[model samples]
Target: MPRITVAEQAGVGLDGAPRPSEDVVLVRPDAVIVLDGATSLRPELPSGGWYAHRLAGQLAEELAAHPDAALPDLLAGAIGTLAAAAGLTPGHSPSSTVALLRWTADRVDALVLGDSPVVAFGPDGPRVLADDRLAAVPRRGGGYRDRLRSGTGYGAGHLRALRAGGAAMDRLRNREGGFWIAEADPRAGHRARTARWPRSAVREVLMTTDGVSCAVDDYGIFPDWPAVLRHSVDKGLLSVLEMVRAAERTDPHGIRWPRPKPHDDQALVHVDFTEIPK
Candidate 1:
């Protein structure tokens, strides 16, 4: 069996309120899973943290029950479980950003729904697994008809739009327009999914909400994913969470941090995926 090590962090913002930023890394002999919940601006629906918690918990549960299942099937089951658990009412429903990783003997499989992204690092360099959509939900539709579906929400819609030739979505991602949606709706699907290059002994895997990604520049400096992973592995994920809290306290202006996104709820998980003999 391959050894898997995971570290995660989540914290409240200066607004003194809870934001949804959930993470999960399930280690199997062959694979691991990572999920993140996107934060939302709407007050009517369930908090992003609530949705992320449910999705990550349910994903972990389903994967545990059927360890050999495909990534899509597992995601479908998670959606059903989430819908059943939270009910279908849009006013008080759950939504989030989800990413899954399944490693096989000679290859690795990944599935992403919404903005929370999966980044894989090996001896070569870094490759992203998810769409990195700005927001996870749609905005045009409205009323009961716009109620988000069981398997979709802010993160999902945001990604779907990007994949559908929506220039705004692409520009938003490239220029750091921010990862959150101004509004929440069902039709707002971003990108459905993406895969990764097959490889063994993945050195590092990351699942993070939009908040953290927005902080990075083209070179990935100023708390880049790699740097974040190293810090987590050394000091512990909880310590990183505390660091975000402290950053909010000391550098609320973002003058020192100087990231595109000044502040918001943030969470991330770092996993070191070691190779195992088949």
Candidate 2:
């Protein structure tokens, strides 16, 4: 069997208040899952953290019951289960990004929805699997962080503006020429990006939510994904998160690295397949 390690941390809110992290990490004998809940703009509805926790639990159950099921099918089934249990309406409920890895005796499979990432380290080097369509969507008010930092009295206004912007983005989701996410719609599972590789071709694998990925994608703290993976294996995964926090501390404002929040919930899972017997 392959060896697996995971690490996670809750991030502070804009007001410097700590909240429960919305990131979820699951490691099973045959699969690994990492999920990041989309931040909620509306307080009346269930929080993204609530949704992510439920979804991850359901996915783990579904995968355990049907270990041989295809990745897409497993996701679809889990989404349906969650929607029914939560009684959420499509386009109006909380959602999350998902990254999944599953393996058999001969091959490994990967699936990604939204911005969460999965990287496979093989003889050819690192191959990153992510969905970047969210970046293409146009945001209003100079983006979420700008509005939040616009002035002292703009906090509520910023959230309201974000709610409006999110509504528009919702329309573009789960469709052609737009992005897809795991909201109330199980069909989004069909739209996820997936890849397959022979077991021999994979030496190690890494799965992370955008929180941890921001270190590479947003801050440029590490030169490349390979460096991030090596660091995680050499040190602890939490050390990578500490590095991100150190960078954030240096740039307290959005001037250096523009983002909605200073800190984000982080979750990561590392798997070493090289030691598994063939």
Candidate 3:
């Protein structure tokens, strides 16, 4: 019973070459699904974007076949199914963030894994449902930030530092005390943060990959979450993404905001809960 509008843009590589977005947004009859795949650094392993595309399809199928199934079970099953088919290994495989929002007759449910967030807005203002574990875990290597602060832009040294950081994180992935993500491991799904609310209490729900979220989360493109919702509903979600891209263009060297790249693939979905289920 909600009206959903979706927006997406493929990000450019460091060289400004157009690349396919790893983020995926899938809509089931009663659910909204979003995923942000981690960029792959190793040439031996399939890219994270490839993994995300297949996993999204599998998860969509599982959700459609079992409408009343638990979210965690569905997620685990989907991940396991995909991994088996792809012959993916636990530590060697690619991973993705997961966000889901579903509505039933009386209530709505939301889930978040990795950094992608699911936000619900209503009379209580905004309730942000996000998984902060990945951020909480300190990175093993981040010398690039130091180098950038010292006046070096996104050069070869910066890329080497980036690869080192990714390799460090890979060592800790899916392990106890490390953050969980939707990778070859099925248990990560069970680790997803989940929340439920009365359908009447929710007026709108916003789901996004960190690309769009960086506007508030990092870019400060908007003042806050409520402002994001206002602008999205007024101008459209695509407009919000354009603002983010504009900001990225201004800070091409990662000086203004030290990030892995100039831009990341973005996906956003805004769901209005006023309409009846068709």
TM-score of each: 0.61, 0.92, 0.96
| Best of the two (2, 3) by TM-score | 3
The lDDT per prediction is 0.53, 0.84, 0.88
Instruction: lDDT winner between 1 and 2, please give it.
Output: 2
Alpha-carbon error at 123 in model 1, in Å? 2.9
Ranking by TM-score: 3, 2, 1
Off by over 4 Å in 3: 140-142
lDDT of 2 by residue, 51-142 (tens): 98899899999999998888889999999889998898888899999999999889999999989999999999998998888877666666
Candidate 3, position 249, lDDT: 92
For all predictions, the C-alpha RMSD in Å is 10.0, 2.3, 1.5
Highest-scoring model, lDDT: 3
Cα lDDT, model 1, residue 217: 30
lDDT of 2: 0.84
TM-score (C-alpha) between model 2 and the true structure? 0.92
lDDT of 3 by residue, 1-278 (tens): 57999999999665557888899998987999899988887778898789888988998999888888888889999999999999998998989999988889799989898888998999989999989898888854347777766668877887788778888888778888888999999998899999999999999989999999999988888988899999998999999999999999988778878887778999989999976567
